[model samples]
Target: MIRAADIQDGRLRGDEPRRIDPRVHEANRRSRLETGDVVVVLVGRVGEAALVEAEFHHWNASRTVAVIRTREPDEAAWLNLWLGSPAVRAWCERQATASTLQRTLSVTALRKLPVPIPPAGLRAHLLRAMRLLEEKAATNARITECAMQLSDAHFAREASDGTPWPERPLASLVHITAGTAPRPRPDHDGAMSEPGTAFVAPADILQSTSPHLYATERRLPRGKEGRVCAPGSLLVASREDGVRAVMNHVPAAIGRNVLALEPESVSDAHWLLHELRSRSAEMAATAQGSAGRELSRKAFAATAVSWPPQEVREQFARLAGRLRERARIAENESERLRELRGRLLDGFLSGTFPKGPLPDDQGVQPEGGLALSGPQGIS
Candidate 1:
């Protein structure tokens, strides 16, 4: 059965249903999804919506999700896009009620969502354009996935099958240090305020597109830059699981429970990153502590890491680098397509989209032509 996480960014995305027990799902056949049907999340973290593309046609959803079948099947795509729009999201939030820690949209409230029904012919251009862009973005995502898989395979092959190389202590390759957390200052309104300096925590680096240091929600006031990690340094989390390593591409101050490593060999930074990622599971196994897994400076320094020959390192670097670069580019294009879809919603719903053979100013028109079919997944 479908769960909230299976519905990603306005698209139903799971290789298989979350619950595939034929006994349970078959009993709820009335709610079984069909192609072009839309699923809107109703309980906890509400307002997330997705279209049931053909791939998920045989699936059924949990009660936490509500399915809607539009009057005109072709308009289902538009509804999905609209549900993901900022206006719709805001409206859903206002309509939601809090129960304990979970916030949800009631069936009654969800049913009343305002839907603008554009002339069927008028939507053809916008729908076709979106479908074409989705296909392009999906193709990019698939290629990126393939490239990353190939890179991982080659890395594993070289590590286990290639000629053996000497192992080296991590301490020999990099200098590691801990970060400090600055206390927040209280404002006149009695709320704690951030220091202007971009103070980072383990959580911020978790979703970074590139392995680079990006600005995060945490910050220190102007003066405390003491525990700073400059660009090219590696920021590692103290904990064993989740996002463990991020290359601080920009100069940023780090908070407590994090370690910053500066590689002795500058050019080896990216290669080191790949090696660490490949060995993430191993690193977790060796971490210290029963209460909460923590990686200490001493433990980290003592850890034995592969020191493959220069040629082997170079080969891995080239392969991983190309894959990462391609993935980054593909992800960026996907973001752009999302932006274009949002623009279409703003224009079409607001009656601003050009009526004739699409205007050059809009930059998105079906004139280039399209064959609408399915949803897309991003990297």
Candidate 2:
């Protein structure tokens, strides 16, 4: 068993692959892992795994299982697919034993888990599908990176102007509206009845993303009389926690901890949203109170905001709008791809159908080249 200190936190590193500790020499280490070994989280929230395509060092582990050296490198990829499969995830969940905080898988139980090894042709087909998915994901990443660069450029231009611009307190340009705590309703109909409306709390605001207004909790119809936000208004969470206390992509009615800023000019919507996102940290820092720091409407209104030249603001609005649109497109495509991958995993792991077959060609193609093949009946 490896120590938790030796295992790098995978969540922080994104997709970068690393290795287990190499310093510890053990003759009978039953499950020795190496470069390209797939590591799966088998014991806890099972099925989360990454391919160890590079070498590193570490030792701490509890719920994780290190895939030992397999007969083929491609088998590691196949294992990743299996581990990610919904069926296997559910199975892992059933096998888990819970402690006070989390459920975990035991090593003996993991070794006894069943796995399907498809025929060579079917295996090749599955790999081909995965390769295509990876290619599409890479393309999506490039587009996202480009959009981020564009945002950086826009901000860079704004930062270059040295002249001090006129400032206006936030209150001057917009109305500060606060959300009310409504009585709890047992059903959606009850919540949306007279004087109730859809409201967003601080947790509802996802910073740097498009507006997300869907709330799990609904307010009574009577409560919404003064809380309805216009379609393009800026909603910010005043409470400092999570993505709340930041600007969101969607316009939502304010909850108790959120403040809605209605810009004087509709044209300034994009600019204001971008500005709020950029200054979220500063705003949060200035919020009052020891615990549950809050940004009062008066305080928020008193906050000074630099007013750039009208033309500059408009230019920023245009650029920001385009960037947001691109991000939305990328986000939608990514969602679709993820759903499709999930469906593929479900089908592949259920043993209901044979794995898809690869094309006749076997050798690796040129880097960044595309390959096409006939589609199966499955959509």
Candidate 3:
């Protein structure tokens, strides 16, 4: 089933959604999603929306997600675009009923959402402009996905190669530092802002589409830059789903739920990252708690980890680091494309766009062209 976390970054995450037997719900069932349906989060993180594509045509959504069946594909697409705007998100937040646990958006409030209807021609033009930016962003996402897949493949091949590698306890090779929660922000507004160290929570790691993180949804206050992991340090955390890890490109304040894994030798950063990534399932199996959501430091430290020869480690790092760097470049480009897309949408909806035909694909390119050439090594 699609959960609030599944709809992120204006799109439905590709991770498999929970499914039910075909006998329980058919394609014609009201609960089943249609191709053009728009799914909106009804509980926490209200207003987060995603368009149901052909891949999930007959899939079922949980009660936490509300399905809006539009008259046609265009209408559904239009609604999805509008729902992502800042104004609509703020309006959703305002309409939602607050509780000590979480906020809930009632169906009545969703029905009252203000929708603007423009002429067919104008709507088509707006959609075309938005579609162009979206396609570019999707392409960038694929580029990063390919780069990461290649890196993982390389590591897998090297690890399985008939080379002897000693297995050692994780604590012997890395210094484990447990993260502490930062002091609550004085403003009391739980929104992400700039000019502070990136505060990483477990959700940040689980929700990230890429293995590298440049920012997070929360930031520590100026004086509260608690336990920080260096740029290349491996930040790991676990939940019921399993263990998740990411390399922070900037100095990040770690949340109590996160654990920063700093390698004893600086050069082992990439090697350690890939090693942990490849064995995420194994490490997750050692996690404590009934739901496997809690990873004990003592247990994690005692876990057995493979230790390859220096030359082998260097070889893997050299190859994997280059692939990771390429992935970072693609991810950065995708981020810029999202920003540009948001600006375009904001302008179009606010009537600030130019009074002529929308810009062509050629005119929408950011300062640098959207293409890459040489591969670079990760620092």
Candidate 4:
């Protein structure tokens, strides 16, 4: 039999049958699930289903609803596909009881749901396609992991000493510049539409992996020469919040809270970026002001930073470039696959596609896994 506890442990990850807890389970202490069982959510946004792939035993369920066990085991995957379809999702949405906290589905409502049974061959093809997508996702995850490892190795090698390297004042290495917002005027339309410029505010600079500028409503076409940021220039946020924000990857027109740094002698933009990220917390803490924290250009220019040799800096940059490229590729692929999955679900459940019949036998039993509880607060 299926049990609510099995679903809680993620045993129904893919095409697996699931057992949801029944109110009667509380008193009997007996599992309510069986092999090839499917758990259908009744309350709180219905139409979510889980197929039971392995046998397990447990009790208890709160917001969850009814359990369905098919006579055939092989048909579980096809059932899962049907359940995840947009048509089914829409049906569930209609049945949901709207409340202030959430939408709920009742167990009785789930049993009467209708599903179309598709041709076996078509169902098999869809399952194969899903498997391929899963494989691609796994591959993308591996690529991202490798890229992270490469970055870690490079950084570890450069910062081995646990202390700042022999260095120079930041002012000596680069020219620091700032940008301004034009005073708001009555006649001037607030929309910025002209080309050849992108404006970046302190909010844009914060939480970016590389320097980037998104389009803004305000623009200054005439003041294009105020602060030009090229690919290798280091852009930092000058506001107290800017000190903690990292530049997203892209050239942006500077906002009032940002500072643009153009390297004077050697090309060590990557090194500088890394150093700034490492020091951001400290810098933000030391920022001066009562109402809003601000980082003065003069104070920042006066700070000293230890620099590694030119060769080391260049090597790190090259390695980082390769890793970042791979990361970008993986990220793009992941997004595409996710979109594909969504579309596939839409087609599969709408009765537009067919699926195979259920199997005659049950699947294997699962091993005991780790237990996860509710969130814990820090002491």
Off by over 4 Å in 1: 15-22, 26-32, 41-46, 60-66, 93-109, 168-269, 276-304, 357-379
* Rank by lDDT (best first): 3, 1, 4, 2
lDDT of 1 by residue, 1-379 (tens): 6765566556666753456677766666767778888888776547888888788886777777877776567767777766888777777877887653345677677767776655556667677877888888778767766776676677777778856678888889898887766533324432225546666665455434345454564456666667667787888774445326777656678765567778865446766776776876677654566623455778777888878777777777777777777777877788788888788778875667756544333343432211222111111
Task: Write the residue-wise lDDT of candidate 4 on 130-159 in tens digits.
Answer: 778867876886687677666756776677
Which residue pairs collide in model 3, if any? 1-18
Over 1-379, each residue of candidate 2 has an lDDT whose tens digit, in order, gives 3322122212112222323444433432444445655565543344456555444322223224534345566766776666666666667666766564335665556566576665555656766887787678657756866776677567757846786888888788788787664433333211134344555555445322334233323344553345467666677764443213333344345656567777766547666665665676677754666544465777778888887777887878778677767866876786677677778755654543343334542322212211111111010
Ranking by TM-score: 3, 1, 2, 4
Please identify model 2 stretches exceeding 4 Å from their true place: 1-124, 179-230, 237-256, 288-296, 350-379
**Top-scoring candidate (TM-score):** 3
Off by over 4 Å in 3: 20-30, 93-108, 182-190, 352-354, 357-379
Candidate 4 segments whose C-alpha is farther than 4 A from its true place: 1-153, 162-164, 181-196, 209-226, 238-242, 245-249, 264-267, 290-293, 334-379
Scored by lDDT, model 3 comes in at: 0.73
Tell me which of candidates 1 and 4 scores higher on TM-score: 1
Candidate lDDT scores, in order, read 0.67, 0.54, 0.73, 0.55
Preferred candidate (TM-score higher): 2 or 4: 2
